[model samples]
Target chain A: MEALYHVAPFTGYIYPNESVVPWTVLIVIYPYLTGLVAGAFTMSSLYQVFGMQRFKPVAHFAMLTSLCCMLIVPLPLLLHLGHAERALNPMITPHTTSAFAVFGYAAGFYVVLLLLENWFVFRPHIVQQAQQRKGLLGLFYRVLTLGSYDLSEKAMSYDRKWIFALAVVGIPGAHGLHGYVGFVFGSLKSREWWSSDLMPPIFLFSAIISGVSLLIVLYALSCKLRKVPIDLDCVKGMAYTLWGFMMFALMLEAVEFASLMYRGREGIEMILEYVKGPLVIPFWTVQLGICSLLPVLLLSFMIWQGTKGKTLIVGVVTCAMLVLVGVLMMRWNVVIGGQEISKTGKGLLTYHMPWVEQESGLTAAILLMAPFVLLAVAVRLFPPWEDGKAAH
Target chain B: MENKVEKLEEDGRRKFLRLFGAAIGGGGMAIAANSLLPEAAATETPAKAAIPAIPGYDWSQHHWAFGVDATKCIGCLRCVEACKVENNVAKDPNHFRTWVERYVTLEGEEKARIDSQQDPVNIAAAGAEGKYRFANRYKDAKVEKAFFVPKLCNHCTHPACVQVCPTGATYKTDDGVVVIDHTYCIGCQYCVQACPYGARFFNEEKRVTDKCTWCYHRITKGLNPACVEVCPVSARVFGDRNDKQSPISIFLRNNRVTVLKPESGNAPNVFYVGIDKEVG
Candidate 1:
């Protein structure tokens, strides 16, 4: 018979109940997906709100990415819950003091904002397709038109105004939603690893970098699939954004870690031991060294050399892919790593992730990929490419 | 220690609860007023309604506390077994409501070596996951100092677990016991992560977070907690501090007790005596 729970193996003297780790890899994916949504929205805002012409090509696509990612953000949490049906209890009678209680409202509000923004942005396309096409696909577009076929200059301007307003509101909405996720971990005074004032900002900065990086990769992939030329200027703009934010993310993380060590509180010794022994590969090697530092250096060199065309696209995409991995590792370090060091302050435990189970590594991998699947189908329906007919 | 101070604390807690209740009520009203459905206001809220009413228990009339005398603990494992049986806790080495830790400082060693009944060697000695025993691994070594300390939920005055519970399913009663309404808990385990003492754990069987409730059912029925009742050496102490003559009250008065992780600011209700500096 299968065991009811996975018991983490440990050393030293952890409280006996500490043997079973509470949050799993699924929890790690929760913040990662939310960060992507926030980050991608940041990219779209660069074009829609900030009026950065270079970002115009990918701005609509970024919004679509944010919406798709936001739609799937609740899955990991739902799957991790023991009674997923009762998940709305937090929203129904939210405990005002609890950080986790705000999630339902925050996520719900952001989803509505994203949906509204996407509708305004795509209404022109829906009207055009509704008039021109036939059969089931045409009916789908027609129904989506919401009974208004006005493509007048006045209506287009009205739609643009709504798009700009929603994007403006979404700046704080998206970032606040992700920052709140960081607060969920940071405000916990229990574990020395997560308790930090710097957590929210750090998560915010990392989210920006990860989202920009994701946009770079997705844009490049889409161009390849469509046999269109990759926009070097657009990719460069996103690369610069990624480079700038990655520095802030790296510095905040370093400062947080240094402060934790310098404070040298009661559990400092055990934390230091864990970092040197168990945290070597995950923290120092992947998160900091290869993924973070290497990407920053590569992007810097590309910018300095005035790199252009395929070389620049390859460089920017490479850095973006590395950053995506780096942010995921950061989430893993914050979520799973916090648990590995027991609250006892005298012990450490190793979380052995299950390969295939309800909340297993496989489930987490699938959840992470699910947004892209939706994004693919959504991009087909909406067609966010610049070469496609512009709605506004 | 005085009734006046206790009254002030209780009053303060009541004020906070009143404010919290008002905030929820006000928010619910606003939501209902904005909602399209007229019947939305009539839908029952799950959290406040879920608190089970005990027939004879007056929770507000008493202040409960627990005490652990480390010096008196013999590591007999009786309290551990009794707790599991009485509470129907999972019969496994990992899931324990109460367990004893043996801290042994060998001669010339700077730190004490610690292990509980869950240690693999001890489980091997006991011959089963459900059983409990402390392995005699240090018998050959020259021991300088050794002692056993029993551990359980502190039922903290400012419980991190209760504060972090999203659904307010876990809450502190007026009598000072932290209890969970299993029916309302969403099973997110945020409380389990928030607890600094590792007191909380996700009950896979129940599909909700679980911990030592100080045997709320037994205490309300005028019986000692199962572990306290089964403790052969009187290491585990339990009673209402409202009665000055109660075991916990007298125990607190007699001992220079300290709590685990005072820096965590949880202000744990569990008092410990004869514990070493490294006990936490």
Candidate 2:
């Protein structure tokens, strides 16, 4: 492990320290997961703030998923730090010029908003749980209620008003949440790959695509598990939303790439080579071709022709899954591809993720899956469904 | 009367021995532990700062910069070795506070084939005279222009590394040297990514970001850094640029020099004579 830091297999002139890429798969996962939270929160607003009736059934569930994902966004960052214990230092004493200094505050504010909004929206259920359940579970529900057992009509209206207000605030908070991730990379003037004005919008839209996709897929799966009919209207609505955002994200990315080529930035050729070489298959095949183009085509066709029954369900599910993969690929390209170019314009470098379980490929894979575990725990606790059916 | 007196004397001796033992055990242990504390705390003691404080030394008055005469560099790797030894830099090929790169560009090519050997230089070839060949593997290839450029922290006036440090762990001193506060560095490597010169590295042993400080300790003591001291050809020079009589100031005035990657707009303080466009 120690040897890897110093003995970088570089092809050309790179600073000795620049030889080994510092940010790893863990950093990649950081933005990827946070983007999901941002996207999910925005998708929930489709019903809450926008009053899209079809999105109503899964709005609360979207909030739950977003919150769950948001909770785990900092896990990768914490793990990546050499001194994980001092993670609070940035929050405690933020350097004003540093873009990353805003992370702790942004994340804290967003999480608090999500918690408050979620609690108010689910207060009725909490009161019921507090009264109906027995022993530790009932005690836990009572504690979660925070001493408010009001089940009156007036109180419910007030909760609704607060929920509405919080949802309005959450729209920009969602953008701020993940847009800041883009700023962390974009603000870096050193790396040509990440230093761009369009990074925030690109990150934000892609985040929406991933979040909406995850919710659509999960909502469909939950309905299936409960032996209930699929919410075709809801699924189609999300698919359309996903399609619009994914198209915007893809377009912005294309513009960024085109400008890089036209302007002939310092490391443009190195990045082009990166896309052509080791990244060829993944960049073109999985990320752009299969995941992006395929889903865009499928979703567009579904929205235009209005397919019925199984075909529509299959298309929406498949497109959602592809978008999820596409977003992850985008993150991989941004975080890892940015490091491929050497600071010395003369050459390029490569990085291979290690298989070691602690801080390597397997560990990143496990960390990516960690949100789902939390989601499961949250489902057991709060029940994101209105039917009171368990989320399988 | 004799027995009582003898008993009283014995009791006094026992009391004295107990006090002596306690003092030796407790006080001696405390003194030893204090000495063994990490250098961070030890450097804070008044004794450590008493290194003949240079007369009239104030950070505000001094603006430091580095100079390199690329034409005179023999690529002996002495500077690289000296820097690592002096700063306790991790002996990693990829982790260097200072290093020498030998650039060889063929005719009619805009790009140069550059190679850097940061490992200890091998000078002990038996039967060989004083003339020593460098670790340049491309010696046999078609040579057009080849010269060695030693690189170190530029101590930029507007250091990107210091700008991106989340906790201000890295900062530019009033004296114009960019340095990392290892005690406060979170080892996030944002500064590493932000540094255009690739001067920053994560020291695995220390678990903190490390960079060339232009030998902050030695500079304050009115001494040359280990690298400058060990350079056989006096190719590397570092001093206050404000000092009109300093070698760096004289060299800057006399030589046609360029800062690496002037396009970066980092305003690097390290000026190089005979630096090629191909060199970073």
Candidate 3:
């Protein structure tokens, strides 16, 4: 008989003494970056897709979020590896044979859309803002446009198409970028927890949920802070979108559980235990209850005939909760939940977050907070909704 | 124990000298496992020059191999310590070239508690009053059987690390060995994800990626891999897969050896004579 002693152990969980293997660090960075992408693009789509003239106020906020989020997409995957420096080898000499790689186009392609969309949509307004402000702010606006001060009808038309076309292309690119992340997990055959076919859909749906929810929350905050009137009807419309996407997101999560539970596949039962245990609170409190169900209830109530301002208020609050809970629970389900199963479907692996693991909770929190700081700077420069007086 | 050491030393010196003698043997035997031209062609024409030949290292001439008896693994830190000293792996929280993982499973079922125990001590530090089983400090957990797998780069014949290096910074040696040309690495981190075994790691200090190199520096001088040399139970084996007469060859012929994650298709050169199915 063949004995087990010929090879050392192989499992994903990092032992306490061995601090180098960072599962949590990689997981947090993944969702945080994806959240921003979802947040920015969904914000843009509200103005373009649903055609809410009022939500058009923060269209630029969508653009800025997309750019900032895309900037840090590579950092998480880089830090996840044993050899971060050798990361370039695959990009430079791509192995067509290995399917896991080949995401080289994700960065340059998305950046082009961002730069174009920014130029097309915001240039004229930035120039006008600069003209009004005589100090360094005006010079900054002029430089932002590279000195093309054209305000002709032709320019306005061109800007709309640029916004429309990029928005169209970016949706698929956004799907591809985030879907590729699902591909990263889906490709790994070592862990059955990540091997589900539903990973791509779940990730994509969650991205939309996180994305749209962020827009609702951030836009409401921006308007309230500025003492400006919010487009209540526009928010009600977004609530519909949020509710629709949330239904699918919740359905997908159920499907993921049902499939794994139905067959009781190798470690699926144990994984369910972790999800229903270590991840139970996050899953129920943040993901299922607050992130998913609460938003649905709010939107459903509005659909059954509620006032615009009330629906808007409920919609914004629901979105904020979804944003906080959706991304957090998704991360825990992946990183912590995956480690709780045995390779042989025999027993369980236990993991608890200690105070100072390299990529501990605090580290993740700091990285997550950085985008808000960046977003604040961007909002000040190009407020999504300009005062109506400028329209005249 | 003293008698065993004395008896083993009788033919040791000259045999040890010849181990490297064969290391410099060079030429006539290399396995270009990732030729990618089609396996049938390789089977038909076995005489093709798989390797163009390099000084002191030749895959065609590779004859040394590695072996391990899992039952004997006491989870000592000797091999890990030796690899660190030999390679100068950084002591940062993010760097690791070679390390030991303890896989603690439930008694009857293969329920696994897998984690890295960075520094492993002898049986004493395992902290048990009466049991023969080893205890992992993370949970002070005990199990029926604890398997310790010392993981490093497998040095595959078709290494994804070299295959993905955009700058040609990583390449397989003339001896059918894979190596990273560190100076050329741009640190984009693509190879880090491409590895099926999760073998390649990013080195922030050097701003490059690193993994096990089959102990190229020592292997060139006819010495065994640090892990192999330091293992008390001879659990890690290294040799030329092409040499049908080598001990690694005999073991492969006699045992049901396996590679980690054959589905990955990298065709790793490092083969375990008796690896479990759950690992890959």
Candidate 4:
């Protein structure tokens, strides 16, 4: 019979149980998905709440994207649990002190908020389809209408109020949920790498950049598929958002790293050693140099030169893709890297992620892609595109 | 001291009665109190009727503690084996309820070299995943200083594990032991990451976080933990700290003992003597 658990190989002295890393690749996916949800919601709110004209083209699409990502946000966590069925136990008998206990309630509230906001945003399209189409698809849209066929000026104004209200409330709700995800790691004093006051903000900023980057990529992809004229102003707006937030993310991360080194705490030697050796490629080269710095430099150059049209599109899209990879690497470094350094402060452990298993690389990859698949179906049904008319 | 014990028992009774009254009057209040005030949740006793009653064990009347004398330990591996057998812990080198560490300072070396039974060399020496033996790798090295430090869960007064358990499936008992309600645990392993000592592990078979409970079942029945009972050199000690004459009390009185990672603020109950600065 095979071993029930994958044992991490280590050097020096680690507690016997430390050989089996408690968290896995699935955890890396959890925060990444959450960040995308928050970022996408922020994009939608720019138009819905703040009334930013540049974001008008993608506002509804952004909401649909946020909802799709938010719906699948819990999958990685559920997959990681040993007792997935008992996942509700935390919500039912919450230990208030635990940062994790609040996750169920927060995620549930955000999911409901997303659904309500999505319903109001797509109501016009839903009403149109319900009146015109006939068949199973029509029945689905009618059921989705929730029996309110009122597209009157009064009803629309009321719906607009509700939409504005939900979007305003969602700004904090979405970001707070993601910031709390950072707190889950930062609050733990056990690991030197994770214990820092800067963690929450760092996570929030990185999340914003990642979400904006994802929007840039997705928006560009959708235009290509639909054969519609790409909205240059909308793309520029997202790029600016990504660039500004990326600066904060990079600075906060640098300060956090600098402080950790300056403190020269008990385990500094081991941390320094681990970073210099094992972290060279992942931390320095990929995440920092290529993914982070390259994108910032490219975006800065493009903005300075007043680049536009195809060049601007290519430049922004490339930077966004780099930022996306950079943020994923950030999540990996925080989650997996924190575990790699032994809690003993005297050793380091290497986690070998299995290619195929219950909570393996394959599962994580599939989960990362699952949201986009749902987004495709959601896009088809709701028709978030500004150019597309309802089926009537 | 006797007066103090009586006072504690009286306080315990009063608190229990208040909780019991609230429980009887409205289950919602107890649940509300539990979720709102973490101290109440931490100290809430397991319903007595739910457990199989021990003949005369009253958890409230006792407070347990453990002590380790590093100087006396022989690195025999007996305690490690005994703990696994007694607890039915996972029979593997990686999962241990209790294990011993060998810390050695070689000639002219500024730092000590450390390894435990889970080390690859030690596992190779033992020749089986279920067995444990420290390798004689240092036998050919220059003479210096060495000692074995036996380790287990501290069963801390402010256990980070219990504090971070999402479902309250793991908690500190009234008698001072931290245990998991295996059936209720979601096995997210947040507690495992929270532990500074790395004492907690996810039990694959049971699908819950497992750790050294200080052998709560056996200790409540007036028996020592398996590791303490089987230590040939009497390195491991266990007794109720509430008892003035208990072995742990005498050990505390006789030795200048310290806990692992004092800065962690865990207030670990596993007091140790003759451990070097590098032991943590």
DockQ of 3: 0.08
Each candidate's DockQ: 0.31, 0.25, 0.08, 0.33
- For candidate 1, list the clashing residue pairs, or say none: none
Candidate topping DockQ: 4
Error of 4 at B202 (Å): 1.1
What fraction of correct interface contacts does each candidate retain?
0.70, 0.64, 0.13, 0.73
Candidate 4 CAPRI-style tier? acceptable
User: How much DockQ does model 1 earn?
Assistant: 0.31
Query: Model 2, B82-157: lDDT tens per residue?
Result: 8888998765566789888888787777677777773223223211222233554655777788899999988776
1 or 4, which is superior by TM-score? 4
lDDT of 2: 0.79
lDDT by residue (A198-217, candidate 1, tens digit) is 99999999999999999999
Give the per-residue lDDT of model 1 (tens digit) for B154-246: 988777877777787888877888888888899999998998888888888989989898998899999999999999999999999999999
lDDT of 2 by residue, A101-220 (tens): 667767877787788788988888899999999999999999988766767897688778878878887897788768878877887778888889999888998898999999988888
**Regions of model 2 farther than 4 Å from truth:** A1-8, B1-57, B107-110, B118-133
Docking class of 3: incorrect
Clash pairs (backbone) in predicted model 4? none
lDDT of 4 at B255: 97
Off by over 4 Å in 1: A389-392, B1-51
